[model samples]
Target: MKVVAADSSSAILNEKFDPLTIVATAAVLVDSPYREARGSLPEPIYADANKGYEVIVHEAELCLNLLEKTKADVVHLDISLGAISLEELSPIQFTNMKISTLGKQHLLKILPRIRKIAGEITRKYGIEVLAIGKESIPVRIAELTSGANAILYACEKTLKENQPVLLGLPSKCQPRISDESAYLYSLMAAEHDVRGFAADQSGVLEKVHISEVLNPIARGFRALRIEPKT
Candidate 1:
């Protein structure tokens, strides 16, 4: 008897949106404090983490619930390890985890298992489910910087699958500098996608960098159109 309230601020409520617009949610282990209910919201919300691998199944179900409620075109999730530890660590420890290759690899290993949940949900709902690690870009720490590249990769993968899933990205990409923590890549990858540069090799539509694909600025692009490639 869990009830998830719809917040008006949710992007899914937008009347006009990009065809690739996706809903994003985070998947964490059960008993995670980061799952705290917002604004006295009801208990048993999907944000509540489930322990162990059960989290994958639980989050997949939650995604479906969200889809049913919002009729969202796509749903994507940010999967993470150390669900409990993520919130318990000190700032330095938390900061270190963002750049730790071993930490990311450990989390990446869990994605395949979770992708199975996406497959299951796809069959049942006829919708696409996309997943990416929170620290999807291994080379950069997203703590105070941007993760445009990782977002682009996930978006490309989602388009290839013809599934709707949230494309996780930093609101803004920061400039690269001498600070060791800064992301080395430029923000063009994300900006390019927003500008509507896309590619279709056979039939699947993939987002292309501004430089990678011809700019669609002439006619303008708003949504992705699925059509057969001739």
Candidate 2:
């Protein structure tokens, strides 16, 4: 099945390829300290940087809405427990929090709730929901801040040989080789087609099988030199 791994960092999806299905995935990071003015999740909603789960039910509804808009065939949601918003912390602080005993306790406390939310979304939407936890993730990607990369990687690997996987920013990204690119390129030698690029090459484009491309900054686009299955 053709699948588009959308970068949901924004409210709108901007993928160039058309797929039979779209994948929306994220982790629930409980935001604990918004007042510190230092390291923390964006705001009240620690898990969803853009939208927090005011109530588990509300979060599920929001998921439904997003699915409707994206016309997604399935949703893969990863719940990252005890993961702090380390955006502004020092290296020491980040390391400390990641390994802190208390932090893990906090993560354990909220895991059940996160699972409930995932269940609600699955039941309400009648779509496949792959609820991923931290343990299931690849050690390399799990060492990072979120499970987005792992989710994308799993999606890419699940495809049969010759299946196409569209990779794009799920959220607003830095220049090139951002975390998103790291995960996308991770699937380069896999059994799927990696379709996405920025204005500037991330420097690893040549490592993968990419016979087709669309301009990164162009408004309108048309696929160029699409590679056919062997």
Candidate 3:
């Protein structure tokens, strides 16, 4: 069982992050030092007013295209597109939720096309998409009204369906906890869904950067890390 703890003086973002310059990306560093655990606190803690980590939301192909054209060393992704299809912003899910939604997101209808597009794009450019998200437990990556099956099944349809390349990703833990390492962790997690990425240090979350109401986990790669322009 994991717990969300709050601490100001020793939060990782405060201690490790460069407060003066904006935190653009993080690298995985390892030492014998382990993160110190703080006392368990209640949920929805809003002591800090920071907007949490800034995230960029765009289609998967758009992201990949950016990566290739720039030839940048690293790219970060957060799956949270923000209630993509939902009408009510107050109760948005899956980043792109739309109006009058009731059941699971239409994964079956969209997944195939989305995967096909990604496959075609990947094939043409060999662009690598970095997958990031919380360690979800039966959590739908996004909301679905009907296309859920195809969205998931699209995995098999793609050429990289079961390739060794598919079993790679940076890390498996929540994004903010390992703020500095999220980028590296994400790279490994992209390779392996269950790789269980390791971090150099353990630290607490400051309410300043993390909002009380945001679903950091449900946000996916869109909500996980920064978009570095290289």
Lowest lDDT 10-residue stretch of candidate 3: 138-147
lDDT of 1 at 22: 26
Stronger candidate by lDDT (2 vs 3): 2
Better-scoring candidate (TM-score), 2 or 3: 2
TM-score of 1: 0.26
Taken over the whole model, the C-alpha lDDT of each candidate is 0.31, 0.31, 0.24
**TM-score to native of every candidate shown:** 0.26, 0.29, 0.23
* lDDT value for model 1: 0.31
Going through the candidates in the order shown, the clash numbers are: 5, 6, 55
Candidate 3 local accuracy as lDDT?
0.24
Candidate 3's TM-score: 0.23
In candidate 3 the C-alpha lDDT for residue 59 amounts to: 35
Cα displacement (Å) at residue 181, model 3:
26
Query: What is the Å distance of residue 79 in model 3 from its true position?
Result: 4.2
CA-RMSD of model 3: 19.2
lDDT of 1 by residue, 46-69 (tens): 222122233344455555555454
Per-residue lDDT for 154-177 in model 3, tens only? 122222233211111111323223
